[model samples]
Each structure stands twice: as C-alpha cells, then as structure tokens.
Target: MSFVIRNIDKVIVGDGKVLSNADIYVKDGKVSAIGAGLTVPENVEVRYGSGFCAMPGLWDTHCHVQSSGGIWGVDKDMLPEAKAIRAAAQAEPVVLSGTTTLADAGCDGNISFALRDTIAAGIVRGPRLLICGYMIRMTGGRAGKDTEGEVDGPDSARKATRKMIAKGVDFIKLGATGAVSSPGMKQWSPQLTLEEITAACEEAHKAGLKVHSHAYGDEGINLSIRGGADVVVHGITLNDENLQLMKDRSIQLLATLSTYKAKLPYLDKLPRWQAVKHIQVCELLEANFKRAVKAGIDVVAGTDSGMTFNYFGRSSRELDYMVEMGMTPAQAIKTATISAARSFGLDHETGSLAAGKAADILLVRGDPLADIGVLGKAGGVAQVFVAGRLVAAFDECGKEIG
Candidate 1:
C-alpha cells in the first residue's frame, strides 16, 4: 500500500497554500513526503500526476448516513436489514465524489455505527465516518417521541448522553431547536431547555467528546453557546451578541446551506409548509452566513445530505454555496478541509496534505480555486484515495472506473 504521485501540476495543501510541480509520497497509509524531486522508494507504484491538482480529500460534517427518504422522512418502520443495505449503498457515491470523511449528524438504532465499523474493516468502500448514535431531543420535539432520542429534564438528558456514549458514538448531537424538516415544529422556538442542553454537553465533554447542537434561531443559538456546545449546526440566525460570544468561545458553525438550497428545484413538489420554510431559510442563510464570515466566525462546510433533496455525492456543493455566500474559493475549500478537521479534532490525523497525516487525498482535473463550481461539476473528480489505498477513480464523464 505505497505509491508516489509524481510531478503534480499543482498541490492544494488544504491550508491556503498551493504548491506547483510537487510530488506526494504515501507509504503505509500515511503521507511520507510532499515536495518536488523526492527519491523513489524500491518496488513502490508510481502514478503520473500530470495535469492533476492534488488536494486533501473533502469533509462533510453534517449528514444522516442511515436515512435517505425525502420530505416525508425515513420510514421508521423500515426493516433494519433493509436500512443497513440501503445506507451502505448510499455512502459509496459520497467517497467517489472526493469526500474522504463525513459525520453522521444523527441516525436511528445502530445502523450508522455498523456502517462506520464495516467501512473500517474494509467490508465496504466508503468515506471515513464519524457518527452520533441518535440526536437528543425533548419529548414531542423534533423527530417526535417515538424516536430513541426523546429526553426531557436535565437528568434524562444526562442519561441519554451516557447511553449514546455506551453505544460508541463519536460525538453528541443535541436538538437545541426545532427543524424545518419536522412537521409542526416551529423553527424559531427552542426545544431543549438550557439545563437539558448543558447536562448533555457536560456529560459528553467529560467523556472527551464534542457536542454539536442543531440550532437555527437566535434564542436557540444563545442557549447552545451557553450550554457549551462545541459546534452549532445550521446556525442561521446569529445576532451581534451571539456572534461575539461564539468568537470568544471559539465555537465553530457548521452551516448546512446546501440543505435548503437543494430543495429549491423541487419546491412545487414539497408540502406548502415545508417549502415555505425552506425558501425563507434560504434567504436568511445567505445574509446571516455573510455576517458570520465578516464577524470572523469559523464556518465549516456541511451538507445535510440524506435530507430531502440534499443527496449524497454532491456534498461539495456546500462549498460552492459557501463561496457564493461570502468566502473566496480557497477559503471555502479550507472550510471543508482544515477547518472541518479542526472543529472535529481530526486535524492531527487528516484534513491536510502533510507528512505524518493520513493519506486521504483527492485528485481533480482542474483548478478549483479558479472556479469553485468545479468541485460540484461532472467529471471534476479524477481519483480518490483513503489511507493510501485507491478507493475510487472516475472517468472523464464522471463515471466510476474503480
């Protein structure tokens, strides 16, 4: 499992530095060297990198890996075997699209955990997965009481956090506010009380795990910040005070802008209530995201893929929306690379093209800095490698070749 990509035209270091005419050497599942004119190792495969731009593989921090149903939501009664099969199949396209790592925001049962383990065991070909077993929510809150995440009071929340930790979750997801995808849930109203949210955060932090709070409105955002949330997912309405607090606490924002934007094309097909909320959120997202950028908030790119029309394999489209909102192409790319890894405490292992880091890299055909949309365009991704192993390769027409 060793190879050298020789004579790359350009190399995006994934930390705002792009080197020209460089070579990347990967051995034993880690990057060994990244510079020009490196000595070739004996018996290692050498791949020509001419006309290719090598970069760190992308990351998507917010996704539902086990669910794929549209606006009506995933069928709760679906058989577990069927769910596992469908979920594994759905993840293949994501890695093929150049995303090397992704986080499952929430999932039912043990599907996501099973998927993550199987991928690690090489039972399946997919991106590196980080998952929260189930999102903690108030009774009658988002996703309803029938779900496993229903918790009320501080003690209940703490217990729920422990349960998820016992289940081997990577992080804890708290539903601080209602969501647009949930019918009858008001997006502006906070769902989990400050005490409840704080309890979950405290328990999770004690276990050395970060907490991602699903919040949109100002009230929910403030509650989450005060509750010690490490990251705010879909933080759409950040006021001046909340923005300042986030800056002071170094709280990162995972803006799932592509979630709502992806639904625009099928607005007519959605229920009126959901469609209206999507439209309103889209408008608010652009303005608020611009404000977040200006306020110097660390914004990470995440697509709520598997939600409605926000399909997998198009996760890079979130970076496109980020560039359109306010970021430069390079900045947007960093959001999905270095910034994302830092938010999730994976920077030391992956995220950038550097020696001693995992050899998770993507080879694209063109310069994404010149046109950010190239990431989302067909045939843009040339090859994808995870841990120095070639997982996927695409033809010129965006067809999977390996």
Candidate 2:
C-alpha cells in the first residue's frame, strides 16, 4: 500500500527539529520522502489533512499489557485464556493515543510473546511490541508465583535466561530491588545477588537481547549499575556516582513514575506503614531524575502502565510529567521518541519522521510543540497511523474523516 499525507502544517521530527508545511510519502510501510510538494502516483491513497500537526508516533518503553486486573498483578486463579483476553483488550487504544510502539515490562505467563506475534500478523490493532516473558527475580522477592522469574544463584539465573530466550522474549526484565508500592517490603533492599544479576545480563546480552533492571533504592540502584543492566526501570534513589556510571556505560533509564501507583489516592488506600514508605520514594522521584538530566544520562521515557492506575492509551501523560520534572517540551518528547527507540534498539526501524524510518505517524489538530499539554488532552490527536496504514482517524466525539 502507498500513502501521500499532504499539507501537514508542521512536523516534529522527534529529534530536536521541526519542519513546516511538509508532506510525507509512504511506500511499502516505510517513509519514502519527506518535504513540500512531494508527489506520488495518482493511484496511491491520498490523505489530505485539515490543519494537522504531524510527527513520529510516540514510543512507550515500559508497559504491562497483561496486568489489566485490579491491583493484584496476576490471578493464577484465572484461566490463561481469560488473561490473554484482558491483555489484548488493553492494547487497542494505544495507537489512538499516538503511541505506535510499546514494550510489555513483564507479566505472569509467556502470553506476551503470543500477543507480540498476533499484533505482528495484523490480527490485532496495537503498537509494535517488544516483550519480556517473565521478569527474573529472587525467590520470595516482590512478585510471587504470580510472575516470578525466580533465580537463586548465578547458574540458575543463566538457566532461567536461556529458558526465556527459547520462549522467544525480545528482552529480559529483572527485579534488582523490592518495589515501592509494596510498602511493607524493605526499600532500597537488594533482591538478587550481584552475581545472579550479572549472570542474567550476560546471558541475555549473549543471546542478543537487552536487560531492563527494576530498581528503586540505593543499593538496588548500585547493583543495577555494576551488574550490567542495559536499562534501569526506576532509579528513584540514584546518587551522583550512579548517574556518572550509567552515563559512562551508556546505560539508559526508563525513569517511570505515573504508573507506579504511588499517588495520594492510591497511597491513601495503602496501609500506614506502606503509605509512609511509598511517600518516601515519591519524594525522591523528581529530584532523582533532575540529577540524571544534569548528568547527561540517557533518560528514556516509560510509563509502568497497567500497574495501579496507569492506563494504556494515556501514555502521553508521562511526557507531561517529564516536562514538570525539568525537561524542555522538545526534550521530553525526544525521551518518548528517539531516546526510547535507541534504548530499545529500534531506532533504525522507527521512532523518527525521517525518510527511511517506518511510517508510523500521528496527527494532532494543534501544535503540540507550542503547548505540550495539548498532547495530553482528549481529541488532541486527530489521527494515528501504523506502518503507513490508517488505523485511527476521527475526533473524540465520532467525527470521521470526510
């Protein structure tokens, strides 16, 4: 299929540049040309926009499509088919929100790989997916049988990683520290031995997959750094040395916040001890990331969506929080676009509006660069495309393209 998206009033390159009055030509699911007066064959589908701001579709680095149930992550009590159904349902609205690519952080069953395949086969309308079948953790760690990749030693870690590789996970997810949401758990406490984490990272890297480290506190953050984590999930307690180490190593940070469910409404529901612990972690989130921003760390964007109250399609709210923390609007968007792509090893395929990348595009009625908040508003994105094909094009109130 071919497409000519004409008369785009402005385009956010997903780098730091913006172009005006540009047109995009897409052929075979990739961008063929990008400039003014780009002409295509008459037989190609022509899409004329009425005052739309175009840009690369958004990228969300961390998500949990399977964690659709209430607070309890996985109900082993539920049938596997039921789990897959809810997870699939959660994926539908992501493109409508302008996120054309996302990754499932970790889930109980290996259903993530199945979902990835279904989406690839065009059987499902969702973003391109990278998935971690199960997150490797220590026995009795934060997640129990619900989703444990429980490994006790280096050997076990390597074996578990190999199993995930055979299961066809695109990447490996590891929990280096206890979660902040489980207030009663020890904060900043290490869950896996450095040796175990090292083994997992080494095995996954050898298998050509990256490892994402789930860390929150001091020691846990350090273990993620020294243990060879490629991406840090939430280093809310990172210190200066940790930031420098990550920068020197080129390790990336997902720097997620909103999806942790650490907000007041959720916290109020927590037990006093847990709520107090969560508040401590929350207090450090902005300051911790600001230090990262100052150190020139590769801070990518991710919403630990599906955790507590974080929804799937509302991933753009993460960009809003990023701006509030310290990034300029452009930089914040870059974290979601180019930076995220680079982190996930997908930059060559998509994440930018260049001529050779995948033609995953989004159209908003007004300029998102002028008011980044517009991206977080309903009906702000007028259209969404995946692989150069029109997937969603309408207003919030049901106005279809004329």
C-alpha-based local distance difference test score of model 2:
0.82
lDDT measured at residue 69 in model 1 versus the true structure, 0 to 100: 41
| Residue-level lDDT tens digits of model 2 in 150-212 | 889999999989998898888899988887555447767889889999999999889878889
The per-prediction tally of clashing pairs is 0, 0
lDDT (C-alpha) at residue 332 in model 1: 93
RMSD (Cα, Å) for all candidates, in order, is 1.5, 2.1
Alpha-carbon deviation at 272 in model 1, angstroms: 2.4
lDDT of each: 0.89, 0.82
Error of 1 at 172 (Å): 1.0
Model 1, residue 312: distance off in Å is: 1.4
- Expressed as tens digits, the lDDT of each residue in 57-107 for candidate 1 is 999999987778466644667787788888899888889888999999988
Best by TM-score: 1
